[model samples]
Target: MAKYLMLKHYRGAPAAVNNVMMDQWTQDEISAHIQYMNDFADRLKEAGEFVDAQALAPEGTWVQYGGEGRPPVTDGPFAETKDLIAGWMVIDVDSYDRALELAGELSAAPGAGGRPIHEWLELRPFMGEAHTITE
Candidate 1:
């Protein structure tokens, strides 16, 4: 199986996701979202294509390489970048088409109002030395 990366991208500035908003959601709504995600994961597992999946924290830190003898410099939680990645999921699939099909399904994840978020996801194929051919 080949691995593919599904990257999550947000459309606008990072808004504060408040606990109050989450708390205010109807129980059924939350349950439906959970079911959707769970079902998707279960499908992947049943197909034996599941490798690993994870959600990432929003906060990020930046590091810079210094001169040859100097130590690396680190900086924090930069907020200026507009294209900050929200999260990612990695999957092992048989082909590029299969990876794209999975990504399309994940992009339809339910959000507020029981509607699909329709968020954009970047799909990238992982390359490894094992797949290379040397003549």
Candidate 2:
């Protein structure tokens, strides 16, 4: 089975059918949305396709290694980071088709008004060995 990374972006993607932001959603709507995500993951786990999943905090820091033993450089809370990744799910599936199907289903998770978000999920396949450069 091939492993895929399913990325849920907060921005930088096509607008969802239900474009209402999560911050504008009601308490019940948020609860329902969370429940849908949990249920989806549970189903995948039962099917043995779920590797791992987690929701990310909006706040993030960009870090880079400094030369030698110097402290790591840090710069964050940047405007460019507004296109933040909301969360991710790792799945092991039989084929690319299956991975696409799963991502489509995940994109249907409940949003505002308890309707399907119809969001766009970025599905990326895990790469194998690196190839040597040829002249």
Each candidate's lDDT (Cα)? 0.76, 0.92
Cα lDDT tens digits for candidate 1, 80-120: 77776766778998889999999999878776677765666
- State model 1's lDDT: 0.76
lDDT at position 32, candidate 1: 82
Q: What is the Cα-based TM-score of model 1?
A: 0.74
**How well is each residue in 16-113 modelled by candidate 2, as lDDT tens digits?**
99999889999999999989899999999999999999889988888999889899999977986548898999999999999999999999998899
Task: Report residue 107 deviation for candidate 1 (angstroms).
Answer: 0.9
CA displacement after TM-score superposition, residue 74 of candidate 2 (Å)? 1.5
> RMSD (Cα, Å) of candidate 2?
3.7
- Prediction RMSDs, each to the true structure: 4.6, 3.7
Candidate 2 residue runs with Cα over 4 Å from true position:
129-135
